[model samples]
Target: MVKYLVVFEKTETGYSAYVPDLPGCIATGKTKNMTEKHIIEAIQFHIEGLIEEKIKIPISKTEADTFVFALK
Candidate 1:
C-alpha cells in the first residue's frame, strides 16, 4: 500500500487535514481523531475514483519532519 503524508491543522472551530501527495483530497472534523478517520476514508475514496477514471495513481514522495530550535 502506498503511504501519503497527511498534514493536520487546527482551525478556530475544529481540525482539518489533507494529503500532500493527493491534491484535492481533504477532510475536516470536530476533533483530531475524527479528522484522522475522515482523511483516511477520503484517501481511499480518492484512490478508487482515480482508478475508475483510469488515471495514474500518484506515488507517495512527500515527507515531513519537525526541527526544534532553542533561543538563547
Candidate 2:
C-alpha cells in the first residue's frame, strides 16, 4: 500500500481531504469515515495516474503546505 499524506478538515457540511503529494487530489464527504473512503479511492487513482505517466510522486512536505490550510 502506498502511504500518502492526507490532510482532513471539518466543515459545516462535511470533511474535505487532500493529498499533499498529489496536486488536485482532493475529495470530500459527510464524515471522516466517508472522507477517508473517498480519499482511499482517490489515492489509488492518483497513484495509477502517476505510475502511468512515470511521474515521480514526492512524499516530502512541500513549502506550500505550511500556509495552504486554514481548514485543517
Candidate 3:
C-alpha cells in the first residue's frame, strides 16, 4: 500500500485536511478525529477513481517537519 502525506489544518469553522501527493483530494469535518476519518475516506475514494480511470497513481514524495522558535 502506498502511504501519502496528509495535512490537517485548523480552520475557523472546522478542521480541514488534504493529501499532498493526491491533488484535489481533500476533506473537512467538525473535529480533528472526524477530519481524520474523512480524509481517510477521501484518499480511498480518490484511489478508486484513479483506478477506474486507469490513471497512474502518483508516488508519495511529500514529507513534513516541525520547527519551533523562541519568542522574546
Candidate 4:
C-alpha cells in the first residue's frame, strides 16, 4: 500500500484535489469531505488504470509541511 500526497485547494464553486505523484489524477466536490471521498476514488481508479496499462506505479516522494507566522 503506497501513500501519495494529495493537495487540496479551495475554489469559488467547490474544493479541488489532486495527487502530486499521480499526474492528471484530480477530483472536485461541493465540500471538503465530499472532495476527499472523490479523491480517494480517483486515486484508486488511477492506480487500476495504470495496472491495466502495465505502467510503472510511481513511488510517493512528495512531502508537505506547514509553518505559522506572526505579524504585527
- Sort the predicted structures by lDDT, highest score first: 4, 1, 3, 2
Question: Which stretches of model 2 miss by more than 4 angstroms?
Answer: 60-72
Q: Model 3: which ten-residue window has the lowest total lDDT? A: 1-10
Q: What is the C-alpha local distance difference test score of candidate 4? A: 0.98
lDDT of 2 by residue, 1-72 (tens): 446778999999999999877888999999999999999999889888988999986675644446455775
Count the clashes in each prediction.
Answer: 0, 0, 0, 0
lDDT at position 36, candidate 2: 96
Off by over 4 Å in 1: none
Model 2 quality (TM-score): 0.73
CA lDDT of every candidate: 0.97, 0.85, 0.96, 0.98
lDDT of 3 by residue, 1-72 (tens): 899999999999999999989999999999999999999999999999999999999999999999999999
What ranking of all candidate models by TM-score puts the best one first?
A: 3, 4, 1, 2
Q: How well does each candidate superpose onto the true structure, as a TM-score?
A: 0.95, 0.73, 0.96, 0.96
10 residues in a row with least lDDT, candidate 2: 60-69
lDDT of 4 by residue, 2-66 (tens): 99999999999999999999999999999999999999999999999999999999999999999
lDDT of the structure predicted as candidate 2:
0.85
